[model samples]
Target chain A: MAVDMTQKPILVVKDLNVHYDTGKGPAKAVNDVSFSLRPGERLGLIGESGSGKTTMATALMRLTRAPGRIVSGSVELDGQDLLKLSDKDLREVRLRDIALMPQGAMSSLNPVMRLEEQMIDAIVAHVPNLKRPELDARVQQLLKQVGLEPEVARRYPHELSGGMKQRAAMAIATSLSPKVIVADEPTSALDVVVQRQVMQTLGRLQDGLGAAVVLIGHDMGLIAQFADTVGVMYAGKIVEIGPVRQMIEAPKHPYTKLLVESLPGIEVKQALVGIPGLPPPLVNLPTGCSFNPRCPFAFDRCRSETPQLQEVVPSQFAACHLYPDHKELPPLPARATRELHA
Target chain B: MSKEIVRYIATRFGQLLVVVFVAVSVNFIIPRLLPGDPVQTALARLQTSGGAANVDIQAVSAAYRARYGLDAPVWQQYINYWGDLLTLDLGVSFANFPEKVSTMIGNALPWSVTLLAVATLIAFSVGSLLGARLAWPTAGRGIKSLVPFLMVLTSIPFYLLAIILIYFFAVVLKWFPPAGGVDTTRIMRLDWATTYDILEHAFLPCMAIVLGNVGFWALGMRSQMVNVLGEDYITFAEAKGLHPRRIFVWYGMRNALLAQVTALALSLGSVVSGAVLVEVIFNYPGLGSLLYVAIRGQDYFVIQGVVLMLIVSLAVLLFIVDLLYPLLDPRIRR
Candidate 1:
């Protein structure tokens, strides 16, 4: 969907903090994080496997479970603070204002119920007075919209392929045409072929509904392909976020730069390169920057003081001290970047 | 039902027939295959026990052999046995001569079936519900307290539990009969009073079975439910804005029950064996008690008849489960 940048953000997240209180201490799964999504915008949040992208997505829907509490954050959807809504109102708001297309497509639908029954359940819970014929029609329309055969609604989940299952989930999430959809790694459990199909279906559905989406995944290439705005998350924080083009061609934050460069160019025949050092433990992050221990350009100041997201270029923000000294990120020294095979 | 389900049922019914045939054949062949002739053994035992030294042994043995058709050729006898089984003519009880074994079984079958089946159904329902609630996040402390109590219940044998129940309710409280199916003094009648008396007499034995088996079903269901609650669909169901109750029942308990049903089918054999001990302890007039009394009294013909009934009933129970499983899970319908 072509994002209307001038439109006011349909969903706003402010100072969101979700932590899992372990015996050692709280694992800050989602630290103080904030972002906004314009109407019909597609924002992709990318990170390492445990970079809290999922935590952020789930928090937006206020579906965070026990031990992992949303300590203090306001998820405002269409001016309604979802965090503060009563349980009933919060429940009503979900799937109507904002919905989650869960990560595990293989298990998203109830195994015991038919696809039609599962879809009808979600619709009936929100719009209780709808007649059975109307519900059936809605289910058929939804199935057809997802490019599924009408016969699919009568079949169980086990009967469907992986791509079909993901499409079915998409159909459910957009059943009410919710203004915001939080898709947490929607294609994680699929093969590349099925993954592309599911992603394309999701994009088409988002465009059809004209609803903003927060697409969370670890794959930089996949997310960049679909997102208008790209956010790189590290240690539960959004380290950088900007237009996808700038974020890919000229990444500002050292971590994002290292991440972008790590992707082997299709034209090159060189071995794969990777960022050195693992992601810092969430509970005990580095003294200043969460990425300082892993950054190739970490200076004395990087170890002493944490940097907030600052505008390095027009519409492009990066959380780093390097932005102050240079107009653009300098090339990484040869020894700084780790090459896997060499 | 669709043709797939019909085919599934037909397949299951065929398996039931095979199992019944094997059991009936085994019951028929094992006795005849014994090293010594069963008629000769019965005659020898009767002579020794009855002190009938003056009676002619040959005449008595021949009469007994002719009475049960043991004097016929082996193949003819096997055919007659099959014919007799078809007609429910299980011959006459040795201990209670002139009373047909089928008549005795028919009299006792209803009591046993009602007592055991109803108690088991109640236990399965109550236990499964309790287990689901226990695993549920919002279930109160009241239900949580049941875990340890259930563990304790599971460990104690049912017969011992029956004795303890009889002691408390019948001996201490004088509220129930400690033994027997009904009061021998009361003439049996078709009325509310008779029904109430039967139910009252059934209470301790029923409680013994229910209390004994409930813990197993509850524990089995709890683990299944825990795993089910962790499934992705449960979270999706919650995200669908569906009420927690709806999620708990349809999304949680319904899926968990597939495993519980399989467990119920596998445990039916043990349930029958366990019933034997409970029936003997309560002196309840059922197939189990009949088997026990016949064994103790050396009533060979009555014992054989009761055993065949038990085997057939068990096969029928398994067939019912086989039919039920596909209804619970469509994946099995194929």
Candidate 2:
């Protein structure tokens, strides 16, 4: 899981803030989020639904529509500030530098178009004047890379099976060999076995293209298997980020700990415990820590002051008062001791 | 073509045939059920117009009925009617004696078809383009201003619009002729002068139909375009960095037009019948006016022929639409 730090990052996002004007008020969807992706690095973004994972991804692409706007952010791809690019320039950056493998394979493709047509559209948009035969050859090769037969190019989106569609989508996303690919739950709609196949295809494609990828999903196991590093998001901010092994084995943040503990195990007979309460409404979040209302470790300071994401271990950061930097805060009793006392 | 498409076409064709048959049969039965004998009514009109009190009305009615083959038994007459229909012989008009029903429809069909074709085409193209612009995310003030105007135009009935147009352009300003499809003084020909006169006279009725219909097309296209724009594919297209124009045309309009195609097909099929109100208001020599005259004069044969023609055209139009649908939408191909 070791990544070389000397390599320049392919994509760098800093202080990203996305707000949605829902008429009632502005809801903070993404708040001061910062991340950097090294070349060929796979960064998994894990969060429950409504955690703004998709919104953050969309904002990075500058594809956020009306009622939802990027309030402030700097998305830098290869030293180019994407937020400052013109509409035309942004469009060029989209397919030529950073591509998106959107969620819902069944619906992501234009149903009326043949697979070849859709793929060629993406390819030719950036590299215009590509001759028909050359485009056709490229499409066939891309499809083959995704393990699809060449004849699948003629089939419409509706004709392809769920796995086939996802693969075709992957082909389209990687056809131009962009430096970065942001996939938003690409395998969420597929079955488990198909999910594995898709993930492997994505992994293989990313390796072949050497593209840094932002893999957004809620499945911790999939992220652990696929991503080199994991960023656990909660209510618009990344509460914990570290190497996948460390995040899974010894999560520092209470939310990440709960997420890991929530995964059902087949080897042992353990009762599954759901997160106790719903996420706070973004328009009116609780004061101090956003998670304080639901946090079992909440104390006087935890309820009074918001904690910042600070490094608790080498290369592992968590935003929690339990860390040593917040020495004034009292730590809760250990879980084992509390259970024994109960 | 694939075997599945062939099977789909076959099934649709069979359904169309059944629909046409039912419609034709209903066309025949409905006219027969109307009270009063057509020949008797025709003879009474003739007598009243001539002011001949000494005429034997019953004898004249019997002779006229016998001539028109109405003296036969009901079942026999129905069989003969179907036989004539199958042979493409529409029989004679009772209202206009000795003139065949086919000849009357033949003379009127062109005017109705031409008027509707021109109007609907203009309406569809302009309305759809405007609708698409209005629904576009980047649509500006100019396009937005047309919404209220289009709403008002569409709210007015065809006849009311026609009457207003006639009052302004024909009566008040004398900018165009008030009535008729063409200048009767000039013999019907394909020369420029004749064509100009026809178009000049057609202007108001055409405007009426277009103004009344364009609003619906624009509104329908706008709503459909809005829905299509929200689809996942549109977002995906944007992600691909497609040109705004290409995305609007191929991704947005292509899907939106699917729903509008049915409306277009139905309107095209009914073109032969013409907009009765527009035709009547302008006194244009179209099928609508012919139908009005035929009904008032109690011409059963002409009524049956016109209704049957409309039904057959509608079924054919629907069949064509069904065949072309899979080409536009791949989901239906399966």
Candidate 3:
């Protein structure tokens, strides 16, 4: 399942802003988020809980249901604006163009129904025109693709262990060979061993389908291992974006620097430095920068004026006022370097 | 495979035995503890006018007690009772001239099973389905608005409703018979039309039983459905791009039904016992009516024996249900 990374960009997003009408007022859950994913590109969207990383991924496929509306966003999948499509049109795009491996795979399956019936149900929903024999063959191939025994098709969800259920879930998610796969915390609830297997299977699926992968989680270590492009989100905004190496070695934003420093190192025992202050509640967000209350480098200007995401280096962007002086800021000090190498 | 089946059968039969033993002991012991000789009371009333009157109280009571073996020591009576229960040898009914308690059960058993089982199945299935619908978010505000009214209907008593239905349909409108099973005129020459006629007369009673049980099942199933609707797997099913209907029916209802089926199984026992009021209301010649007559006549053997039989049947049904729990919920198999 070795994919050619040289293929054209398959999914692109520009100035995506999503807001939820919570009756108290409209809270901006995702604001001015933008990124492009090339075919077979493994992009990791890493942030702490409530950072709107998942909201961004869900908005891609128009999976946002009720209250959480896509207020202002342009989600382009191969030049198709998903926002403008009708309900019927969105269904066609969901499984064929983009698929989702949602959070909580263990409890996500039907308990009474056999695993194969669930998979077959997914196939009929998207490709209703496929004959029964073709559908059967496709489902079997998918189970094998995810490294499951074909005999598991007859077993119910409760019969399988947590890891097996997750693998089976992934099998159904990718049954249609969707072009873009958004895996939202797919391995969060699994053990470390099973997590590796699930993630590895996800990587292989991305390669096999040549899909643009959006891996959403709070684990920076996992993103560092698999992602090609890393988007560091803070309080519903993508605060930093760049090639994985540049973001890891030469982080510009204070929050991204803290996130990278917080990763557990292999060598020396460096005290992990976590970002201070909680993310602003979506109901009544901070006036200027949402991260300003937590940003240690918050000057008078930072407190009063929100920072627009601007280019700080070649093909690298950061939403912080500290990068205003230097167009291409150098990497942080090696004490921070010990954060990754320790 | 045979070993598993054998183990299951033995376990079920063992549970049935325990339940039967406990129920019979309670039936026998509770009456004795309630004060006064039941045999003496029966004979005292029989020896004179229906009213409690003074007569040769000692001699008549002694003759009655000795005749029925009630003059034996309490421990010996208890042993005989247990032995008769074990042998399915229910003694003569004190109320009937020569009828055995077991004969009464053999006559009335079919009537009870048919009336109660059919009514309960109808109520549970329809009520659960309706509850599932009410729980659906897409059912809209107008349909959702009816849930409270339906719940109110469920709270009304079945006996009160049965009497009201009898007054209107039987007395006022004269659409059907007021009471009793099938037409007695055609009882000996039973056929399809006679069977259908019996069911027609039994409909109001069945409706009463169903009315009492439907509310609980609907409310329980609806609440469970609401909880299951929000689970991650249901959302995952939607994310897999499955149709809204398939996700609701296959993923939503199927999982929700696993929980509902266990509740339904337990309710079967309750329906059998609870059908007493409905049976009495209709005079359907079931065990309820027979028990009513036996109670009025102070027939100790018949009352105790019938109570024991009902308990044993309920125990057997419950045992089968417990064994079936793993079939509905695969998680329980482990």
lDDT per residue (tens digit) for residues B65-168 in model 1: 77658768888888888998899888766566657889998998888999999889999999999999998988798889999999999999989999999999
* Model 1 Cα lDDT, one tens digit per residue, A1-342: 677778999999998999988888888989889899998999999999889988888889888877788999888998989999999998899898898899998998998889999999999999999999999999999998989999999988988988899999999999999999999999999998888888888889898889999999998989999999999999999999999999999999989988988888888788888988899888888888889988888899999998899999998999999977799998988877788976
Error of 1 at A114 (Å): 0.5
True interface contacts reproduced by each model, as a fraction? Answer: 0.65, 0.77, 0.77
lDDT against the true structure, per candidate, is 0.89, 0.85, 0.80
- For each candidate in turn, the interface RMSD (Å) is 0.7, 0.8, 1.7
Candidate 1 wrongly placed segments (more than 4 Å) = B50-60, B71-73
Candidate maximizing TM-score: 1
Candidate 3 RMSD to the real structure: 4.0
Sort all candidates by DockQ, best to worst: 2, 1, 3
User: Which numbered prediction scores highest in lDDT against the true structure?
Assistant: 1
Better of 1 and 3 by DockQ: 1
Ranking by lDDT: 1, 2, 3
**Per-residue CA lDDT of candidate 2, range A231-310, in tens?**
99999988999888989888888888878877878899655556777898988878888888878787788888888888
Superposition error at A80 for model 2 (Å): 0.6
